[model samples]
Target: MGRHRVAIVVLSGTFVLDLAVAAQAFGRRPSVFAKIRHEPETPYDIVLCGPTAAPTSLGFTIGDLSPVEWIADADTVVVPGLEEPWAPQDPTLLSAVAKAAEAGARLVSLCAGVFVLGQAGVLDGRRVTTHWALADEFRAAFPRAHLMEDEMYVDDGQILSSGGMLAAADLCLYVLRQDHGQAYANDVSRVLISPPHRAGGQAQYAKATTRPLSGSLSPVMHWLIENIAEPLTLQQVAARANMSPRTLERRFRTETGDSVAGWIARRRVERARELLENSNLTVTQVAYAAGFGSTQSLRRHFVSRIGVSPRDYRDTFRSTPEQSRTVGRPQQGPAGTPACDAGPDARRPGPFSFMH
Candidate 1:
């Protein structure tokens, strides 16, 4: 079969890293894979599509790019983040993007580049994500779009978007996995030294909490974090905070935007993830370390919040002597299915969120 065609649309003041992420993923096969017998050439025919010359956000100029009109012929089109997303974009470029989407070409946006798709009117009712800091502005500018700001990346059928700059790599890898298969994407990830699949949303990296803590709840939150491994009840926590259970519950809801139980459960899941990735703890040990009552409790929360089992997550992320034995091997989950499906709804688990 012919190679898939990928067109990366470059705009004025484009963030160079965003452009590079897509290019690196689809542009060429890594030299490390060259000597492997029977290895196929890169499956994507990538072209930089834009005016003859454009200024990047880094104050450098890129010339000799394919014209914007070439976007119409691409099987997939990517828009990298722009330095000034709210500034006016080239009308001709937006028109071409719209045309490509209307023709059923897959559309991708990295970070603020989602603003370009919004301007092209293709984002209406589509689930998408961008840098979390830009969430309010993006919502205001494109209220018709369904914004999942908590996700690191979102795959809404033909339209895909990433939360921030590095997430561009995540979205690209996901698309590659969908087009090829898990083994192929894993090979590319090995070459890039990136995880074949990241298990959680961008919320893990966000510098700010989901909600700002009031003075009354600030100490309580810190205490919770410090004692995350303890199996303390709400009443115990309330006593520690010197408040009635009823008052503490109301305070938690008001300050954290989540019930006390819900907040603690999320934190426990996060703790479990940390132990799985960084420590050599077995699943049961990690479960107890993360404050889950039992292995069953840990598994239940992992499936609900992370979309994968603790064992699968560790196998994918942990650094171990066995890593070389399993790194590029295709993983199978329940009922002999691929550990992670790459279909339209594949990204539903843990979605993606962005920092900054």
Candidate 2:
């Protein structure tokens, strides 16, 4: 298959880190993957498209970028955040972005880059996210858009957006996973030293409190992680922390922005995912190992959190026999096709609303 074409739109005052994130993820193929047998080469053809001699927010100039017109031929168009997102954008750039959207290219924005999508009129009525600090400004500027302020990212079919800075990596990896599969994305993550997937619904890193996890709650969290395999009840957890269930519930919501049951369920789902990817256990065995009482229970929670069945997830991520035979390390096998479409409706509820 031909490589996917990715065009990054560079504008004046572009945040260098944001640009670097997309460039690193798609522009450059990791040399480490080349030595591994049967690994798919990088499947992206990346171009930085903007006016010549564009000055960045870091006071440096990026010269000899491809022309903005090149975005019209891209399969995916990425817009990185600008240091001054509220500043007026170049009309030619906005027009090219609008045209790309009209041509059905996937639209992506990192951080304040959503503002550019908003200006291009492609974000109206679509779900999107941006830096939490810019949420109010985004809403004020584009009231028609459904702004998910708490989300680390939002995948609204053709338009995908992420929160500030590092969330760019999250969205880029997500797009990679969508285009390729879990195993391929995982290998890339290993090379980058980043998690393969952080749920888009996961909360953005906003300071909700001065003490996110109080001195009292820190130990409880560690304890829970250690005992994640056990089917511990909220009462049991609260008792372990020497607090009433009611107090513990309130504290959990305040400190973690999640209910006790919700947090535990997320942890269990993560455990199930790990086992599914790395172990040869059957579905039932994985369910029991991950603290679910039954395969039925595992399927319920897995589908709700991961948007696919446990069996399907394992099938997509499990290493092949050829991959398993490699000495000293597991090779990422062939890319798995995404089990579902990229539309938001195909995903389960956000992490905040997981079954409790």
Candidate 3:
């Protein structure tokens, strides 16, 4: 596999630690995985930059950062949190990201770096996350981008945004898991002693249960979350909530800012994602349980919200927990594990290429 270059933008007041979370996960090679593959490991090159080729932040001046061109050739670009937004990123840094995205390079930002991605226009029309305290302002600032409160991170395919420094690590581990299989990803997790997965779309932290119920319609939302896989329509949920469809729709938007259909669909997708990542259910089984009624429907929503299909989700996680093997290293046995793995999946494809 050819080495994939990474470019991490560093500016004045940039949080040094946030830089390392990705820097450490991808920047340093662990002795553990060295034995797993014989090919000389692909190197991860990190180029730290500021307004100029030389970064002035980081508590001292440093030089020789190559140019922001590093971002154009980089397979991935990571933007860590800046200290209080003191440095808005050299205009070139933001422009480079735009150029990279146009070229298909994946863009990742942690914490307030969402602001940089926002400025670069990479997050347009995408759902992204940031520290909860800043979510309100972030939304107002970037009206085009949907802001999800309290999510640990958000992986919207080519553009991934994370919650904070810790969430930065989650993003890096996800990259590891994607680039190397679960085995190598797990080994890196063991080496770092961090959990293997924290899905990008999960709230940075669960919002406090302080939201008050209005109009006695909350039970419907609860039921929807629990029965996500069933075929549900506005009339059905309206009937369950004992309200007119218009009233229910208004209430749903008022309480969740999600239309009735959008609300139910998101819950169903999240349910299926939770199970797919944490359970071993087949695409078809998980579909039925999550209320999609069929695997195709489930895959439709799965890709819409999570960016990958159900089978890909299960294949990526089968060797881990949340399956039939809990109380052991594996949470449980997988339902649709890749055929080559031989744990399950009667006709799954050979494992998807990791180095691609």
- Among all candidates shown, the one with the greatest lDDT: 1
lDDT of 2 by residue, 1-356 (tens): 68889999898899999999898888767677665425645678899999897899999999989999889878999999998887877788888899999999999999999999999889889999999888879999999999988777889999999988888989999998898887777777877788977643433134332234455688998888788767677788989989999999999998889999988888888888888778866566677687775677778787776667777676666765734565654333235422221112222223212233
Tens digits of per-residue lDDT for model 1, 65-165: 99999998789999999998988778888898999998999999999999999999899989999998899899999999999887989999999999888
Per-model TM-score, in order, reads 0.65, 0.58, 0.55
Would you list the C-alpha lDDT of every candidate in the order shown? 0.82, 0.80, 0.69
The residue ranges of model 1 lying beyond 4 angstroms of the native Cα positions read 1-3, 37-40, 209-356
Candidate 3 — which residues are off by over 4 angstroms? 30-43, 52-63, 199-356
The reply for model 2, stretches above 4 Å from the true place, is 36-40, 199-204, 209-356
RMSD of each: 9.9, 12.2, 11.1
Select the stronger candidate by TM-score from 1 and 3. Answer: 1
RMSD to the native, candidate 1?
9.9
Question: Please, what are the lDDT tens digits per residue for candidate 3 over residues 1-356?
Answer: 66787888776566777876777777766566566544334457666755553333367555555677678777898888876653355678778889999999988888888888888888879988877667767887789998876567777899888886677778778787778778766766766688887543434133323445455667776787766655667777778888898998887788778888786677677677677667656566676687666555666677766656676666655565334443435322356333222233322134321110
Pairs of residues at least 3 apart in sequence or in different chains that clash in candidate 1: 151-352, 151-353, 152-352, 152-353, 153-352, 202-353
